[model samples]
Target: MFQSTAPQRRSIPHGRRRAALWAAVVPLLVAAPIALTGEAQAATPGTSVSYATTCTPGVVPAIHGTTISEITVDNATPKVGDTVNVTYDVTQPASGNPTSTALPANVILPTGVVSLGGAQTGTVTVSGTRTNPPVPGNAPFPAFQMTGSFVVSNPGAITLSPGNYNINSNYIISLDTPCTIDTPPAGVSNTITASPATVPNNRVITDSPSSGPAGTKVAISGSGFTAGATVTVAGFSGTTATSDVTQATADASGNLTATLTVNAAATTGIIAFEGATYTPATASPPVAYSVTAVVPPGGSSQTLNSSVKGGTLSMTQAGSTVTMTPVDFGTGGSSTGALNAITVKDFRGGSSGWSLTASNTNFTGPGGSSLPAAGLSWTPSCTTTAGSPSTCAAGSAGAVGTAGATLASAPAATLTGGQFAAGANLSLTVPAFTAPGSYSSTLTLTLA
Candidate 1:
């Protein structure tokens, strides 16, 4: 050791000097965190901070590094009066963590401001729980996710900044953690663009019955109106409208129903009706109704007559019932008989004449025994009492089978209308083994 100093110098105490140095730096350190949060008052819209500090115990609390919180909105473009949701997440740092674990950590967030056009009006209230996992004694603080909501009152670019929050330790005590946002880095913030409010379309439900006479009561109904508001009903003729001034209140479901009387002096034309309100300045869609002029008192009866003219080619029979002369076969042989005269009057007025056909069902007798309709044969004779250019010809001789035969027919160029009479000579053959009994069959005559 070289002891070359001529005078001995007094040394200052290391503990006192260190204490003085710490006293100066400690105040600056405390004030630095506060200044960062206080910048929120003069912060630009949409700017947020990345660091935060806990003020729990109102005294010494852990100050965390950056990567503190992130805010997100459910709707970025919300219309006026629309409710929007916000989420604030408290992220854990990479290294720092508490030594002890607090079970069931419930985060209670604070209320923030909604800034629009540089003027803050609406408030956002955040709340919810975010618990930590059951780790051992040494464990990092768990992340927290808090939620909140606010209604968009005005339209424009809007900004949101999260406020201070607290942790409810074990559901027993509250711990304040003020994580106020400061001047933000570029493009890091919670921002949204609000759109103008939209209006609903007017709905006019019904006006019953398409047409009605004047002074008639018409039921009108509509929907989509202010609740418990009076509506004015009116009738519009062309561009001019006459108000019925019928007062009707809207129900809880925003539906309105009212009765409107057509004007007594209304003309016979199409008219429109509407239900309207003034407070919100809304009107329902126009419902069209046809209004008929009122008829005079004694004008009910009007003499009317119609000329009855024959339309289609048709025929009518004179008699209701007829009986053919019966022929008996003594020992089961063929017998011939004359058929009753069939008189038909054709009142058809067209040159296209018609043909008359005849058919017969099987003759069923006692004990369900039957004879085939083909067992009978006929020779038809027809005559028409019509004018010239109209002629009726008798059908060809053939067996009267179930399929029927043409009894009489007039050609297309024949008479337009006439009285026609037909007669047939029928011959029936019976087998020797046939039972002896009387049988009847239905003979159908069709004119087409």
Candidate 2:
């Protein structure tokens, strides 16, 4: 048996002395036992003592709370090298009492985003922790606070893209989406975002020949807009009357061309024009379109010698109205006399034809006495030339006789292709017994 010395010194061999030291150290070492999670020692002789002293954290938290309350960003759509502020909310586990870890939340980085420089941490709020279950207690210490910022490396590419990232490294969450955190205490969701985004410089409009008279057809065109969109072209009529005259569908390349009919009565001035998309409609600034009044080509006139050959008459147009000299019959002259020759020249762009007609077949004068229809005659046939054509034989005086009846001139005057000419000859017979001081009759030549 080995004995220990009590304040005693003795001479012994070196090998024996070494054995004695070993014997003493062995009992003390055996007396102190190292437990997996507690301290163990012999306190009083044979009385054993054991209690928890320090905690050894395992690889993971004991009770991992899966709920992530929120994740906020300073700039959701950041350009390359643009610092983005981020914040997260998550409940930390209770410490010392047996719960989870106290690491603050973290914001995951999106692809193509490289951290450059920014505030790496934000103020953190921790839920009160308890070590005594349902009893008053305090949280022992703080776990590592997890916070940081990510900056964009390629700004041009990163902008206008969704923030698709996570709130922590352990979860595959999205900043733009409500993420479901799947940990022990599951069924918790997280959300994140900052600003909205859109593309720019995508539309234009133009019109050809911006100014014109009423009824002019204008061509409207556009490009650089959303493809496959329906565009409506409206012409400004007044402050309130915006008439939409044409509609076009955009092609895949975002181009369109259409024609619009300007109202014949549209007000003259700067006419506003606009092109717009129907779906999620947007409009280009109103462009000015000039409207002008139509100017007359100017009036023309012509005169003709009366059938009396000696007398004459003339025709003229004032504005849109036409006037002609009155036919005159001399007092008691020849038993039979001719009236006059009327002619017409057409210069209308429509190139339409016209006809002439007489209101009555005879003449009436002072005493209400009238001349016989047979006394009145005319050559209805006309031609593009100033004189009658060869086919106008029946047009001779007394040739086309509807005895005692009315006569309407025919063989329409026309602007054949471009222009036309026509003439008319009238004849009358005077009864010797026509009791009158001066004779007069109304002859209306309606030229249309």
Candidate 3:
């Protein structure tokens, strides 16, 4: 019912709060969309409206309002059917009044809402509890202020849950004057828009190998965390290796991975905490872990190597050079030139047998011109192509020893190793008619 004392508006009979506000003396039976009207024409400028604790001065009059404010349920995202407190009001002193003032205000809401006060305005619906403006002058109410909420009612096919709501609190204040009633504005209302609501997702933590031995490396991972956020991974030990922590950062994808090394002394019943931040407001689910004193079969790995030492053999020539003194048949009978002692080393690991051979065995002149094989002999007795013995033959019956062996294509003698040094005595018995015009030969020794 309309009263002369105050112009009160009610929630659309059975509807949801939308972005628009609607008001009518009688319930609007039609569900047609309400044509939006602009801001109310300036109220004479002689009267101003201010919601601040202290009104701003030195300015023209204007109407500023909050068209859309959030309404949540138990701190969660706002859903249809949720209870909420919605407040709104207009402030203007009622000191000067010609006859009376009639300013109609209404709350329009979306279509799908249920529960909470909702009424049928010509079109839209809305929901929210408001702090209504106190009666104009008397009842201890905020001057020219108003507030209230509407119930989201579902009448028939109308849904009070989710939709683009046209919730507006519109008003047109009229002042009656004896001379002439002041011409007021067309429409004054709060217009606002809001993004759709959604539910919050839960966070999660996981690991590669859930259980392992102390000192084993494990990969810790997390998901569904805030983007570009920092989280700490803590290791809580039941006994021995006690407390430890590390931090990881989430990428734009809201995921992160960190590696943790189990303490060698860590015991069972270990836990890891992936905190939202250094000092988090919310505690994520704790990640449980286990550590064993003995490393599991494949937990740790060891590498071994097998090696062997090689053998080396070496031979050193007395001086790496051999020089022969001139031997002349002019004073022929016997001429012996002493050569450097050749040394052989048995280094085949542990004393092995070896042999040595000399090339050209016999001293020869420039072009294949040779010397008598019998004429040259060595101090050691060995076999050769020439007569095995010369003038120094085995004379004694039981003694099998000759003075020396002859040097043919090869030395009538061979050298034995296992000895450091063995002397090479060259004996040359020159024949009386032997022609000699400075004879020289190259002797090469190969050892193995």
Candidate 4:
């Protein structure tokens, strides 16, 4: 009877609702077993998963919070002309054995970011391990760690768009977990210089009195010369003349002057002036002057008689002597004979008066000597055929007079003829009472 009452009309919808609930609950229950199993599996020691990932294309990965770090390059973000670098590290948890392995790193660039040239790239590895092994082998427990890295170079960041760029590196690491990456700040550098040479001034030299008489003054002039400049002249003969004779300092205007007396005996030669050192044919050319010495004419001396007979008389009987002497006409006249008169005799005709004449009155001598008579003569009449008064002709003898009457005492004379008698007769004779007055004559003497 109790069982029959139990069936007291339960609603089908409630049963259905219960059934759906059971269904849902049963699956949850089933899933619980699997979840627990998985959790247990995860909790077991030595559980691990491969750690590696490709880096963003064309970008370099940065490092953070870990001791070990590394970078690598791969195809993930690969671009025809792009390069990238990545770094990885670990944080917390230590590992007994640490190892680093290569990981995929990639580089990529926008069409305009990279040029057609090949991209520059590099790679690196990082690793760290705990000092002690965990327990001994069963399975070496790894310290908390991380791996893999990527390097990427974005051409967009290059100085010029579509220009080649470089990817620094990629990295892989062990013994460090939860690693982060950071990009290092970029570095820049640069350099500079200068240019040129030197400059100089011009020089000039001049000389005065381009030409003059020997022993003349010569002045050396220099213009546009340097200060403390040295000057020289060549072709100098005496001590007064020298190869480097003159020297001077330039004035404010770079002008200089030097005065010197040229040697009177100097021969014609080139006069050269120069700087500290001889510079032949320089702008300041050397100057020279033609010099000449004046020479005077030589002189001679002669003697003549005061009187003689006839138009001409024998030089032998003229009672006149001649001597030769050398003289320097340049200086005025000079004589070396004592004053005296020579005598001449004429044997001409009646009580007629006769005149005596001589030629060349002045004479000079280094020593006393009788001068030569140019001529001796006497005129028969006071007047000559030409109606002119008779006069002694050159190199001729003239009138005769009484001996001693026309003669004067001879002073001491040193004859170049060696010597003469102390009382040598220097007398002439004429007709008695012939005109009576004294007649004068000239004589000339020459010496070697």
Task: Score residue 113 of candidate 3 by CA lDDT.
Answer: 24
Pick out the ten consecutive residues of candidate 4 with the lowest summed lDDT: 31-40
lDDT of 1 by residue, 1-448 (tens): 0011122111111100010111000000000000000000000123444544433334345554444566766556567786666666656422223335344433332333322232234556676554455434335456666666678877887766555555433334454444433333212357777777855334344676545666778787767666776666655443334443365777888788887777634321222122332221254434456665556887764434334343333344333233333434344555455555666554533334567776554455566445555666689999888563457789999776545688787765423556778777776666655655655555556655
RMSD of 1: 44.2
What Cα-based lDDT does every candidate model obtain? 0.50, 0.32, 0.32, 0.25
**Candidate 4 whole-model C-alpha lDDT, 0 to 1:** 0.25
How many residue pairs of model 2 clash at the backbone? 5
Q: In model 2, where is the ten-residue run with the lowest total lDDT?
A: 23-32
RMSD of each: 44.2, 51.3, 52.4, 65.5
In candidate 2, position 442 carries an lDDT of 34
Ranking of candidates on TM-score, top first: 2, 1, 3, 4
Candidate 3 C-alpha lDDT tens digits along 133-211: 3233212112222223343223322111211222222224322111110222112232212223322334556665756
Instruction: Give stretches of model 1 more than 4 Å off.
Output: 1-64, 75-83, 92-120, 134-140, 151-157, 168-177, 182-188, 192-281, 287-448
Output the TM-score of candidate 2.
0.32
Q: Which lDDT tens digits does candidate 2 get at residues 75-158? A: 344444444433332223222222233323332221211112222212222221211223112233222212335544432322
At residue 368, candidate 3 shows an lDDT of 35
Candidate 2 has which clashing residue pairs, if any? 79-155, 80-155, 81-152, 202-224, 307-340
